[model samples]
Each structure stands twice: as C-alpha cells, then as structure tokens.
Target: MAHQSKRTTLGEIGEHAAIRVIREECPSRNNGDDAAVLNQPAPNTRPVVATDMLVEDRHFRFDWSTPEQVGIKAISQNFADIEAMGARPTAALLALSAPKDTDVEVLRGIARGIQQALEPFSAQLIGGDITGGEKMVLAVTALGQLGGNRKELRLDAARPGQKVVANGRIGWSAAGLALLRKFEEIPEDLRPLVEHHCAPRIETNRGVIARATGATAMTDNSDGLIQDLRLIAERSGVGIDLKSHAIFPDELLCRAGKLTGIDPWEFVLSGGEDHTFLATTSKETPTGFRDIGRVNKNTGLVTVDGLPPRHEAGWVSF
Candidate 1:
C-alpha cells in the first residue's frame, strides 16, 4: 500500500512563518531610531526599549495556558519591564518561532492577544518576524518614550532608612498554580484570583509616581519578593529589612486560607510573576504603595524578621 502525505498550510509552519512574513513586509528599524516607522511617527522623548523571551515548557505549559493568554502574557511582561524602568510603552515588536505542525489560528490568536494587551496601554505593534523551530518561543521587545526630563528610577540609588513600597498584588500565581495542580477543579469564586495569577495587572502609574516621589531605587517584582529585594540590595550597596506584616492581601488566595489550604504569606513572600514595582524613597511613598521594608547602610544583604531573606527564593533561569 502507498502512504499518503498529510496536507499543510502556513499554520502548520507555526509562528515562524508569520514572523518572517511580517518582517519581510515591514520597514526595518536597524538604524537605531527610537520610533520605528510602524510603531511611532514622532521621535519619542524617553526612547526606552526592552525585550523578553518566553520559551515553551520553561515559562508556560501549553495545556495550562491558552494561545491568547500566552500572547497577552508575552506582551504584558515586556511592558512591565518598560514600566519598571519608569517609562511609558508606546510600541512593540514580536518575534516568534514554533513547530511546523501547530495550528495557524493559535498564532493568529497570539497576535490578537498582543493587540489586546497593547490596546489598554494605547500602544501599537510596529513589526516583527517569524521563524521555524522545534519549540514554541516568543521574543517580545517593548519601546517606551519618556515624556520630558523624567529620569528613570535606577536600582543603584537605594538609601539607608528609605522605606520600601509595593504597588501591586502578589502570590496569586503560586496560589493559582496550586489550585490547578492539587484541586482538579477551580471554584467559581476563585476564578478571578486565579486569572490574576495568570495575568495580574501591572502598575502603570506607580513607576512615574515613584520617580516623582524621589525614589532612590526601584524595580519590578518579577521574581519573588525576597529575591528581587536582594537584587536592589546588591545593586544599591545596602541592606534591606522587610516588615512582612505590612504586605497587603491583593489576591483572593491572600484571603483564601481555610478553603485554599495554602499559606498566603508564603506566596506573598515568595510567589513571583506578579510584575509589581518595589521601590525605596526617603520622601513619602505614594498612596496605593504599601511600605513593606526599609533600606540600611549595610551592603548586599536582605533580611526578614532580623534574619537574611530565607523565605521563598526568587526565580532562577537555571
């Protein structure tokens, strides 16, 4: 008997094809212009740019997340980097690669998801590329423009006695993952918090607010709180003491003690991917910013309850 070859289309080629087609069709920004012709017409003032790569299995599980969700996450994470630097994102470029046998609509949905995430920020997608690969990988680059002379809140300026503040929620992702793993079903009431774990909102205004408030140092909580704070401590040449009691419950799991069977404090302390900003400033912190710690003169040490930050270690690429 003769064998029949399966039919295929652009979708079968995965995200790579889409990226290649877009790159070929779009103008190149290889000249170092802050604003790509596709992304912005005027020269952006701040002209900040950041890139993040999402690899399959490492960053996300295909079964656990939808294509749209993955796409949105890719965009949101890149934007969080921009916001962390105290800039406003104005445009983005997506580069994708995947297996040849994948569905085409999934790639389309990814693009739609990027558009969806961009819509809320009033940003635009300029251009990108697609290439063939054995796995699914998304590389997103986000560009931001500073409005005027607004300097970025670098991580090197933390000062002694400066209060540390957080702008958004935490531990929701860890809590949500626990629900998905231990409990086969997600409670209807818990859906919102789980969704937050999947996609928690980033504080767009707080970055500027922190900068305006004279923040000495700042960074986003992409990794767990302890680990990220350690970064600030090392960079600023200072020691930090986290007053754990001050952390607020921003996720449903924070309040889901009896039913969720999870320790909310552990998640709040160690849970990552929250994308919230943690900053230090001598002046009064902003209104929504909750003070969680304070900086000291000692260099490169972070502590909780008088001990080195031993709570939950932050994310490690390794």
Candidate 2:
C-alpha cells in the first residue's frame, strides 16, 4: 500500500494549526496580537529597523550547514545591522522562501532555531511571509529601540583623530571554512575555534555600550574589516589606518593556521562574517575593546603600515 503525503491545502490544515506551529516553534513577543504590535514611542525615543537578505549559495552551503545553523545565521546577520546602528534589537520579521517540496519538519526546525537564537536577546518575531522560490532565501528585518539622550552612532559622524577599536575577534570563521572545505582533521582543542568560524561570536551589547559611551561612528565587521572600515571612512570623510598586530585572534588558532601555511593577517584584514564591532571613540575605550587603528581626515581608504590590505580572495557571499 502506498502512503499519502501529508501535503494538504492550507484550508485543510486550518489557520489555528498554522498559528500553533509558529507559536510553538518561533514564539512572537508581541503578545499574540493579530499582528505583532510595538509599543507607543517613549518620549524622545525613536525606533530603528534594518533588514538584510541571504540567498542560498550566495550566503551559505546547504551541504555544510544544518537548517538550524542557517536560521541562526539569518537572524544573527540582521540583528547585527541593528547593533551597528547602536540600538538594542526588539523584534525580527523573517520572510523565508523555499521549494514547495521542502519538508515541513525541516521548516519547523528552522523556526525553532530562530526562536532559540532570539531567546538571549528578548527579541520577538513579529510577522513574515512565505513563498516558493528556485532556491532557499531568507529575508530578515530587525527592529530596535534607541534609549536615553544617546543617538545611535552613524558612519557619517567619524571624526579625524578618533581612535579606532574593535570589540571582537577576527578571522575565526574564515579559518573554519577553510578547514571545512579542505576536510583536514582539526585537533580536538581547535573545534571551538572552528565553530567560531562557522558562527562568528556577535558583540551586540558591546556595540550598544560603545554608542552610549560616545562612539563617533561604528560598523560591524561583516564585509572584510578593511572593506567595511573603508565604507565608514568614505561615509564620514576620513581615512583609516589599522595596526595589523592589534587584530586579535585565538593564539592556538593562529599557531594552527601557521602550521597549515595560512597567513593569519589575511584572516584578520579580509575575513568577513566576524560580526565584530569596529568603532571610533574619543573617550578611553572601555575594556573588551582593542584599539586597532585611528581615523584621519581624507577620502575613504583603509591601510596597514601605509600599504593596502591583501586577501587570498574574500569572504563568501551570494
């Protein structure tokens, strides 16, 4: 006897069933309104929202990443944009497209991953749409709240002579991807570093703190650091000089890369998806921030020891 697929029309599934699945898998923080509703603006506060898209093949490989990793990465990248604006993330709207043949269980797993990732930050899922596509695509928009008298730092505010600092490690993801692609055996102790490369540690709170502490400008190290820093410089009418030695990486990871004939500086300068905060500040930067460079008045350019940064290729993207 042949078994029937559970594929039923939305009419047969019932609206409540669909809502229940989402509620259980990706609970929204908006208190079950027909639509997620944000609170009335607090006096003198403005809501900030940003969105980004990730297309399969362009952003990730289905073979290498679990569905959960895919969902988390999608959420993490969009939330990072909110952090770059110096605001605290409050909610996310995700529109996911997949082949109609995609398994419901797999889709549920992706939603579960999104829920889990949002738990730490108290961000809620508002609403989103689903449609068919040739390949998987995730579009996420994150909403945030700006607090107090502090304005979120924008790229335009960078000033000459401001110290450049970074609030997270660099290159871990690039190295991890390399090892994964080469299928080389990594030592047991290096697994964590490799995982960090798969999913770069995000420093959202640090970004918000830097903004409150008077950061003049900021951007997340999503594109290679040099490229992203150059964006800030161009937007702000400044040039940036980064001290190569100051790019922090896990020492053991660095040693491992050396043994494998990989240049650590390449990871530091051109690796993307690190999600680290590179910011300009006038005040003594707080702990956890490494002073990596400085800003100068000029057209956009990023340099190391007066030379252009190098890259074997560049970070992955679609």
Per-candidate clashes, comma-separated: 7, 4
Candidate 1's C-alpha lDDT?
0.74
TM-score of each: 0.84, 0.87
Expressed as tens digits, the lDDT of each residue in 1-318 for candidate 1 is: 398666454555644556544434332454123434643435546578899999998887777677777878888888888877777887888777877766666676677677778778877677766667888998999988665565687888888989998887767776776676666678888776667665566656677677777776788788888788888889889999887567645547655544667667767778788787888988998767988888987788887766764466667898
Instruction: Give model 1's TM-score versus the native structure.
Output: 0.84
RMSD of 2: 3.8
The whole-model lDDT of each prediction reads 0.74, 0.75
Candidate 2: residue 147 Cα off by (Å): 1.8
For candidate 2, the lDDT comes to: 0.75
| Over 4 Å off, model 2 | 1-19, 29-35, 184-187, 252-261, 312-318
Clashing pairs in 1: 12-100, 16-130, 16-131, 19-129, 19-130, 20-130, 46-146
**What TM-score does structure 2 among the candidates reach?**
0.87
